[model samples]
Target chain A: MYKQNITKTPKAAALAICAFLALVTAACLLCLWHTGRSSGQLTAEVYLDGELLWRIPLDQVETPYTLEVPGPQGCCNRIEVRPGSIGVVWADCPDKLCVKQGFIDRPVLPIACLPNRLVIRLCPAKDSSASHAAPDAVTY
Target chain B: METKKLTFLALCATLSLALYAAESALPPLAPIPGFKLGLSNIVTLLLLRRYRPRDAALVLAVRILLSALLFGQPLSLLYSLAGGLASFAAMCLSGSILQKKLPLLIGAMGGLAHNGGQLLTALAVTATPGVLAYLPFLLPAGILTGMFTGLCAWLADRYLPRGPSS
Candidate 1:
């Protein structure tokens, strides 16, 4: 039926969209890993679809840092890390709005990129301290 | 035909400029870029039917410059000029080739062209190729808004007795 064909195409588009979104989500999740275990250095990894793209050391970095990465296919920020790890300091995208966002190192907080559909979250890693007195990153 | 067409173009330009100014009184639908009723297009579509390509282009030029003055933003000048010219050209070309009275098709093409032009201008201004990702995001909205504006223009053309026949 004509309807069947029509439905099939949307499914494909949806699948494509889903796949793209999943990649962004994975990137977000990957950027959230914890790299500190009493070493004073906080390490963060950036990924795309399970592929490791970056490993950064945030240890002894009491001040914020800015990391600019190249944007992906869509007009999206690549990555940025601000001084606080609380600010966005990474982005390859031209806008650099995300990178300008500054550091947001709290475990509960997150950063987002609309174009590349990428996101970065800060969460406790395997080596994460069970109960650090510091605030967890939380994004509203 | 020449004098009549010139008069018509001048009239459309003036009318659209006035409307453009008046529309500013209304609040924005959203804070995002490229959201408006584009009411000035009513004159553009009207001129399309009654005049030639050259005359229609003149109307577009006058309207764009006058509106830019009223809006007063050199930063947005590139976007407005490019978008307005592209949409006008699209409407003119499509009207000539398709030779169809169907307003919807004309409107759709105009909307698509406008968005393309805006995106191009944005890319140029920001010097960032990444903004292309937002193009897909804008298409559906452009189509819907284009159809609505086209319908308005069509209705105005059909029901509102011709304005003095130039």
Candidate 2:
């Protein structure tokens, strides 16, 4: 079978591999560009399941505090919120991936605990009225 | 299946499972969640190259199921299933078209598909679009790790003694 199917040239294989790599690299760049762009103000939003559990303005935090988020079947994640950053300090889940993620002050990536079904993300803080009026409208 | 063929595939499954367990015992490669070396895929790639895709799938299924039962939560099983199936599909498609050569490319494609599958599962399970931000970070990671595993498979396929033909 191997001998019968040596039809593809080595040059063609190399070109295909290069093309695939380039395509994925371009996509990675685009995604980074979209997520890395920072707005003037940032708000950290904590989510349990899909619902918005809490929205804290990262820029306005003067003191550090921790919040315990409980999920189904007694799973929990303890979040540490500092002046300008947030992270999961503790989690009851088997894999402490969230805690290992450390802290984030920017809106680039989200901290997620899959076992606990918890997600913490940063978004551009909107006006008080707009944010208050539609808490669920926050995009990611 | 012949007894000899079955035994060889079973041995492959065990080796892959060992690889999976060993990889998991190590510290997380990166701070980002869902980042992994996926070293066990080396076995899957080798199987696809040397045997039938069905044989490869059987071994993969066994590894995923047994590994999850031994060392993972219920939710992790879901993620593994999605990623494993998607990875297998990508490898089969690429291996068929590209033949035995260019395992690197095939492995990279499998890695990308695996992450994409897990990301989609995360989206559904968590119901948060914010997790999509992980896409940029995961894509590059998948490519690099996938290529590494693929190279390992290529080396193994080249040096290992030829077994009974499927």
DockQ for every model comes to 0.03, 0.20
User: CAPRI band of model 2?
Assistant: incorrect
Residues A10-116, candidate 2: write the lDDT tens digits: 45765776698779879898777765565657888888886789989988988999999988979988899998899999998998999999998767778989888
For candidate 2, write residues B22-123 as lDDT tens digits.
Answer: 998897867577889999999999999998899999999999999889988778788899999988998888777676678998899899889888889888
* TM-score per model (chain B): 0.86, 0.98
Residue pairs clashing in model 2 are none
For each model, chain A TM-score?
A: 0.40, 0.69
Model 2 chain A scores worst on lDDT over the 10 consecutive residues at A131-140
TM-score of 2: 0.69
lDDT of 1 at B40: 81
The clash count of every prediction, one per candidate, is: 37, 0
Error of 2 at B128 (Å): 1.5
Per-residue error for A73 in candidate 2, Å, reads 34
